[model samples]
Target: EAGVAQSPRYKIIEKRQSVAFWCNPISGHATLYWYQQILGQGPKLLIQFQNNGVVDDSQLPKDRFSAERLKGVDSTLKIQPAKLEDSAVYLCASSLDPHPDRNTEAFFGQGTRLTVV
Candidate 1:
């Protein structure tokens, strides 16, 4: 199965600088998600979108992190004034529906590793 695509496999930025990551979800997938996985920790959901409408963004740090899915397709995540604690592998995932069932399952991208120096 073809996986979702993410750009900039790795990124390193000084603390307080800004960084952005891009994602291209699998075709026909209607639900998209973004997650942050800090070192030694499991991936944590940051935001999710059903089509172009935001379904959840409770975990996203609105003050520093922002994400948007344009036209219900490609997505971008940006963090400004990044902190050292923000270093992580950002993962993008998508599914045919919001809830997984026998027919549809979520697919994840390879992720973009971000390092805050």
Candidate 2:
């Protein structure tokens, strides 16, 4: 597996600013996920995609966050008018299929650390 890949290892911006992170999942991975991990807490599911379509984004802050997997290969997550509370690590992961019955494995990138002041 080529493994999930992410860019911009770190970023720092003032409140109300904007930033975007990129992710490239492994080849042949049909399911991609984006997660947010705050300090001292477990990672939270923000969004997921099956191919180029969004499977679930209910947990994503729509007003301030947006994501897309245009070609079912790569994805991007953008946060506009960022807030201080948004400071956290944004992780990108990919899996073969997230079937409830199948125990699929996932690969994750190191993630991008964002600091909003």
Candidate 3:
């Protein structure tokens, strides 16, 4: 009955510092996703995971951003040497299936707002 969970609702750091965010998806969900949303822009898919294996990560910035879904349950996203452009909301979502045509709707957690100074 519980929804997805995310930690550290807000974070602020200097441009060169590193930050990490955590997420725990709902039970029975098989598809988990991480998104980035800058102000005034729609969320952009950064990565997608089907269970513990990565399904997509083409949009993720390998230079500084990384994510992982451990044990097909909890997930973590990290940004090292953060840039000013990294200031945005990091959203975690999950669905019962991976196909976009499926009827299942993704449930989102309270996003982590990152501010890079």
Model 3 alpha-carbon drift over 4 Å, by segment: none
Worst 10 residues of 3 by lDDT: 97-106
lDDT of 2 by residue, 1-117 (tens): 477889999999999999999999989889999999999999999999999999999999999999999978999999998999999999999998888897679889999999999
Candidate 3 per-residue C-alpha lDDT over 2-69 given as tens digits, one digit per residue, 9 for 90 to 100: 99999899999999999999999999999999999999999999999999999899999999998988
The local distance difference test score of model 3 is: 0.94
- The digit string of per-residue lDDT tens for model 1 on 1-117 reads 678999999999999999999999999999999999988999999999999999999999999999999899999999998999998999999998866544557799999999999
Q: Cα deviation in Å at residue 27, candidate 2?
A: 0.8
Candidate 2 is scored at a TM of 0.96
Candidate 3 clash pair list = none
lDDT of 2 at 65: 100
Residue 112's lDDT within candidate 1 is 98
For each candidate in turn, give its C-alpha RMSD to the true structure in angstroms: 1.4, 0.9, 1.1
Model 1 worst lDDT run, 10 consecutive residues: 97-106
